[model samples]
Structure formats: C-alpha cells, structure tokens
Target: MRLYKYYRPDFYFEKSLRYDEIFFASNEQLNDPHDLVIKPYFGNNKEAWKSILKSNAPFDTWCLSKIVDIDNDNLTRELNDEFEGVVVDDSSSISSVLDNQSASLAQIFEKYLTPQCNAMFKKPEAASAACVQFLKEKLARGWDKRYYSCSFSKNPLEPQMWAHYGGGFRGCVLIYRGLSDGSINLRNNIYISDSQNFKFADVNYQDKDKLVDILDLNSRVNIIEQNLLNKSSFWSHEKEMRLLLSESFGSIRVSIASGMPKSTKTQIFHHAPDAIEGVIFGSNCSESYKEKITSMLAEKYSFLLPAGVPAFLTFDSRLTSQGKVEINYGAKCIIREVRSSQVIKEILENERLNTMLKELGIPQFN
Candidate 1:
C-alpha cells in the first residue's frame, strides 16, 4: 500500500527532510473537538449493574453515596425498602426510576457508574445513581491512557486536500510505500515494555456516533478502535488512514526521546528508509523550496533508494481541462535549469557520472 502525508513548506517540512521524522499528534491536540470522544453505553439494568459490581466494590459504595446522599447508616434500611426481599440483584426497577425521574440520568449515569458497581441501597434511584458513578470513574481511569496518531491519505491528487492540508496548493505531499494494504513500518528510539509500538488502521468514515460498551471490561481494543479509527462521513473526502502509538502503561515519558524536554506536542518516530517512495510538490510549490528538497534527496537522503535509482519527484502543475491538477508521473526528478549550476557541479564531481557525460560529448569542466 501507499500513503500520502500533506505538508506545507514550513519548519516541519524542513525538520522532516533533515531528520526523517514522522510526528504523531496527541488525541487532545487534534483539530476536531469531538475527535476521539467515545459515548459510553451501559444498559440501565441488573446485568449492567452486575457487571459493574464484579469489577469494583468500593467504587459502587462511593457512587451510591454521591448520587443519592445515602450513607452506610441508611444503606441497609434503604435496600430493604427498595428491594423488598428481592436479592438486590434486579436493578431494572432502579434504572426505570432514573429514566423517568431525570431524562438527564443517562448522562449522569455514565458520569458516575462508568466502569463498575458494589454497594447496595434502599432507594432504587439511589442505587442506580451509585451504579452509574462507579462505572463512570472506572471508564475515566481507562480513558486516561494517552494515545497519539499520525494521519495519512490514500489519494494525493485531490484539490481539496491541496487546499486544506497542502497549504492551498503551495505545499507538498509525501509518499510512503507500505508493507501491506494499510500497514507502514514505524519504529521508535525509546522502548517501553508492554506498550504498543505502532499500528495502522484505515479510517472508517461513518455518520453514526461511536458508542462504546462500557460494561465490557475486556473491550479495550474495541474502545481504542471506536475512538481512533472512526470518523464522520464529512471527512470521507480524504480517504484517510492513521498510524497510532500508545504511551507505555504506567510510564511518564511523553516523547520518544525519553527524559528529554519536549519542544513540541508531536511524538516523533523514524520510519524505514526505503518506505519513502517519493514526493509530489503542489501546483504553487516554490521553485527554491523544490530545489532544496531535491538537493537533500540527491545528497544526504540518497540512502532511501538503491544505488543508481533516483527517488521519484514530480510537480503537480496548473489545472487541466477537467479542472483536475496535472501531474506527470513519468517525471523522474525535479531538477530545473534555474539551479543547474549547483546540480551540474555535483554531477560533474562524480567520477562515474562525469566519465559517462564525457563519453556523450559533454564539455569537460576544468
């Protein structure tokens, strides 16, 4: 597979070309406020409450106290009145009360009883409140684990992409060759045991909201997918993909460098050298910027390809009759006569290539 990352000719582009760095944005730093937001769903009934209680007992008691203002003193008395010889297991009655009494109870329930339940109570509403609070806290704990991602697109020729991500056709798009349909090779410098190194997911654009089943304690992977892989249909134009990296569990290191002060919010990683297939400059990309980039590839970053094989470079020129950007995929390099002095100097300095030039009747420089 191939992936495209759009970039403006800015400091970030310079850093990426110099360091071969791919930056992952933290979930909180994403542009969309609703991005990664998971709407947790826990059925307001006995089964959900039972699942909650099985997870944590103390949290259950705490939720009950906060939501209904009930204490240990009145806990048993309230339980007897509400449950009425029932096993205190049938929580459906309590949920029904929460549903009718407060339409906002569902939201409150998620806030309080997010992950688990433990305490028993007299009033069904109070017990329901406690269950809600218990689960809420548990879910919050799980959600606190930090996540970061770098986005990519399947298409590079789209004009809208050029406008939005490519700085209004003045930037460029990086191309990467992947191992499979949606996978890319990304390795970090610092190792964090038990943490995910990297994973690629093709973005799924849908109109429906991502609802996480908070009652299922074993659904960690599902939660991550729902939050990261899914996007609104409005973003479907991008044909997006993502590379995700998770922070090491229980570790405080935010950047891949570890212990070093982070100068930016981005988490950097070095990609496999050969993964970089080529670069396509936008229609309005400056000639000087193109020269700088091609020079870097010709000199320091030549290791990206096999010897004698130049990395592909092309200019996305003026719009075609179809109103689509024109790109000559046959173009092998971005060399321009405007910068011919430096390029020719470097070519002539190479003994192997200079000999070839002489054989072709090219004038020899002293």
Candidate 2:
C-alpha cells in the first residue's frame, strides 16, 4: 500500500519535515506531489497567485504511484543501455489507450510500490487507503494550517503531476458528500490560460511569511480559471475527466469537490450532457443552476449506486457514444451533494478538526 515518492527539494523539503510526512497532492501541487497534472495552470498566473494568499479556503491533495520493479537497478541499467526514446507506432485506438486501467492489484502497483512494500498489500484499494491513512494520521498529529494546509498523479514525478488543466485549481468533482469515489469532469477541455509570471521578486522564501504568501497566490487562480471557461465554448465532444483509482460508488476516501463560477457551470449544464456528473460545490451560485443540480441529484444514470445518487463523471454523456450509461447496481448509495457552500466552507475552513471531519462525512480525513 506504499508508493515511492519524490519531492521538489526547492519547495517542499522543509515544510514536510515539520510533519515528518509527505501528504497527498490535491488538484494543486502546492500541497504534495501529484500525478495527473494535465495542464500546468499556475505556472504563469501572477494576479491569481496574490489572491489565494489572502484567502483561507482549503486546498485539494493527490498521491501518484508507479508499479515498482523488484530488479529496479538491473532493469534500469538495462533500459538505460537499450531504451529508445520513441514508442513504436501501432493501431491502438485512443479509447483503448485511454482505458489503460489496471486489471488487478499486481498489475496496478507493480512498479509503483517497492517489492517489499507491495508484498504487504492484498488489494489496490488497500494501497490507496493506506496513502490517505498516512496523511490523515499526520493531520491527527496536527498540521499548521498556515503552512501545511496545502495539498498528484502517475510517475509521481511526471511533469503532468504539476499540471492543472490550465487553471490553478482543477474542477475536481468540485464538491461532494456521502460519496468520495466519483470524480469531476469538464467538457471542451476549456480553462483559464495565462502566460504571466508570478515568481517571487528575486526574494528568498526562507523568510517566515514567504512560503505561505507564495501558496496564497493560488486564490484567484480558480476564479480566473472559471472566467476563462466562460469565454470558451463548451465542447460536447469533450469528456476527458475520470478518476484514476476509482473502484465503485462507495470507494470514498480523501475526496475533494471544487465549485466553478456560475456562468461557466450554466454553459456546461446546457451545452454539455451533464454539468458535473455526481456532485458539485457552489460558486456564484444561482437558483436555476441549483435546480439543475438538484434535479440531477435525484436521478440515477444507471443502477451503479441508487436512484437518488448522481452519476460519476466516467459516465458523462460526452465520454460515451450512447449519450448515457445504463449500468445498474443493486447497492444503496452513500455519496450525495451539498446545496449550500457557505455552510460547508464555514465548517471546513474552521480550525476545529472533529467538526470539519464530521461535515466531510468521513471516519477520517481522505
């Protein structure tokens, strides 16, 4: 259940030492190492960087893994001596390439966790659960909100692990409750794109407030992300979002939901088959949009969970040719949504640990 980890010695080494731990990466790489960084949104946004520093919202986190090879040294040497930079051409379908899901525990973590580490696990879910547990345990020991309250992807070192679909915040399921297994999806692959640099002005970050101030810079990034999404057309053909390790409706763990701007959500709701597949959080929330989300909340895409539970993004109409998935599951759904963001945020942003975890609806943090 353990994964080999890497860190940017420049940014995280010292902060992690405070907790004696490395946390999961959220949609934001500011927290921990991430894997699915599709687009590096925060790389150049300057104005948005300043706003996040002043705001107090909590951020998302992720952990990327590779199937560890027992004979890593030998295999690495072999690959180094013989590996080619190019992949052979083939007739593989994009869908097949995209559906490169691991079929078993062995296949999934084969190169991610060391052989000694992998030997202790029985299932892939267990390894995922252990990753979250490790983070939660650290929080149990207590983290400095001002410092450690920040939050990855495959390779755990791949460049994408630092990407965010062109927004500092990736619209991760945006918001959810009762269920943590479902992931967020956006159509059109649209997001706020910026080319401005927000780097510290030749100032060293060892300064007390520098690190927190730097991380705070991400606040306005989401708003900018939404604004950009608004200006672009929502492509119905886009359905690139999906969970990496999701097993079922109830595979709930350290889950995150991010709310998109109202105008952006409206376009997706009408243009895209589902605005957000399973659940969403509110931002610039409006009555009509609320109704749309509420209505979807009451319906079931298939029997995967229950009649009232919303469908996950994997079944988003944009992803399938049939327009919707009809798979039925007999299990009752425990994942649901929150109608009010203020109430949830008030609880989440507060420093009280027990109350925050309660509203999050997890026995522990994800």
Best of the candidates, TM-score:
1
lDDT of 2: 0.25
* TM-score of each prediction: 0.62, 0.18
Please provide, for model 2 over 285-355, each residue's C-alpha lDDT reduced to its tens digit, 9 standing for 90 to 100. 24454344333333423232343334332110011233221111111123344432111111122334334
Q: 1-366, model 1: which lDDT tens digit per residue? A: 667888988998878866667888864578765565555544324443344334443433453434432323233333224323222111112232322434344333333432223334454555565454443343343443455678988777777788888888888888776776456655564242232345567888887766655445567566656667888887888888888765532111211112222333338877654556667787788888877776765554444334433434443344456657655322345223331312322222345534533443222221
Model 2 earns a TM-score of: 0.18
**Residue 281 of model 2, lDDT score:** 19
How many backbone clashes can be found in candidate 2?
A: 43
Task: List residue ranges in candidate 1 displaced over 4 A.
Answer: 56-141, 190-197, 218-220, 248-266, 303-310, 333-366
lDDT of 1 at 191: 47
Off by over 4 Å in 2: 1-278, 301-366
Q: Model 1 residue 23 lDDT?
A: 86
